[model samples]
Target: MSNLQQQLNFVLEIDRLKAVYRQAMVKSDNNRFENSAEHSWHIALTAQILSPYAEDGVDLQRVTTMLLLHDIVEIDAGDTFAFADQTALDGQPEKELAAADRIFGLLPEQQFIEIKSLWLEFEAAQSIDAQYAKAIDRILPLLQNINNEGGSWVKHGVSKTQVIKRNQYLEKSAPKLWQFVLEQIELSVEKGWLKPE
Candidate 1:
């Protein structure tokens, strides 16, 4: 196939991401669960808007790109709830890596390598860009839960301690955002949205 055909095919295949539902509900859409595609878009925008607060010298464009491509693997491996226990998460990285290989392989060779590299960088969350992107990614779900009266936290019986432990990395990537998260957790607990233990 021509490069154009390969690119177009990849684009068309990724449309399936819209159908992959996540545990978090859309805050503005009543109680509807958010899809992977929407989650990607929201986090990309969040990265852009929050970039100024990221570590000095962070690349906003790369962070946005990482956020945009981070969840494409969910199209195949499916969405894993953030609160799932370790048993439920076993082998998820391998499954997602396989999905990445297949999904990204749909692109032309060079494009595949570049996109896959960005996805891997996001997964590693080591670089400044990836760290900022990851911080923004984690923020959106908290905002969704807070807006929807603890949307997934309530449904999954998640506690404040669990939420903090899961997202503690945000403190290193975006200290200001981490403070905001802490305040929100306290507020959520006060509102009876999240368990206090």
Candidate 2:
């Protein structure tokens, strides 16, 4: 196949991500759960909108690209809930890596490497761009859960401590967003949506 054809094939294949439902509900959609594709789009846009607040400067374009591609592997490996217990998370890394190899390999060599690298960078969450992208990524679920009256947290019996630990990266990467998350947690607890630990 031509490079253009291969790129198109990869594009068609990733449309599957829209079918992969996530555990978090969408606030504007009558409490229906969101899919990975919607999550990707929202976070990419959020990263752009919130880029000015990143303490460490980042390339907004790179951050948006990272956010968009980060979860494409979930199309194959499946969405892993952030609140899921460790037992449910066993072998997830292996599964996602295999999925990445197969999916990103569909693109032409150069595009494949770039897309795959973006995915890996987001997974590592090490670079300033990746860190900011990750912080934006983490914010969505918390926002959705709060808006839905602790949607997944209540369902999974998640405590404040677990919530804090899960999102601690934001404290250093995006302090303002971290402050907003802290306030949301406090309100969620006050609203009886989360148990204090």
The whole-model lDDT of each prediction reads 0.88, 0.87
- Cα RMSD (Å) between model 1 and the true structure? 1.2
Model 1 off-target regions past 4 Å?
A: none
Give the per-residue lDDT of model 2 (tens digit) for 1-197: 99999989999999999999988888788878899999999999988787777876778889888888899889889998887888889999999999999999999999888888888988998888888888888887888788777898998888998888877878878889899889988888899888898
Model 2: CA > 4 A from native: none
Error of 1 at 164 (Å): 1.1
* TM-score, per-candidate, Cα-based: 0.96, 0.95
Cα lDDT tens digits, model 1, 11-79, are: 999999999998888767777888999889988888888876787878888888888889999988999
Stretch of 10 with least lDDT, candidate 2:
49-58
Native-to-model Cα distance after best TM-score fit, residue 53 in candidate 1, in Å: 1.0
Q: Quickly count the clashes in candidate 1.
A: 0
The TM-score of predicted model 1 comes to: 0.96
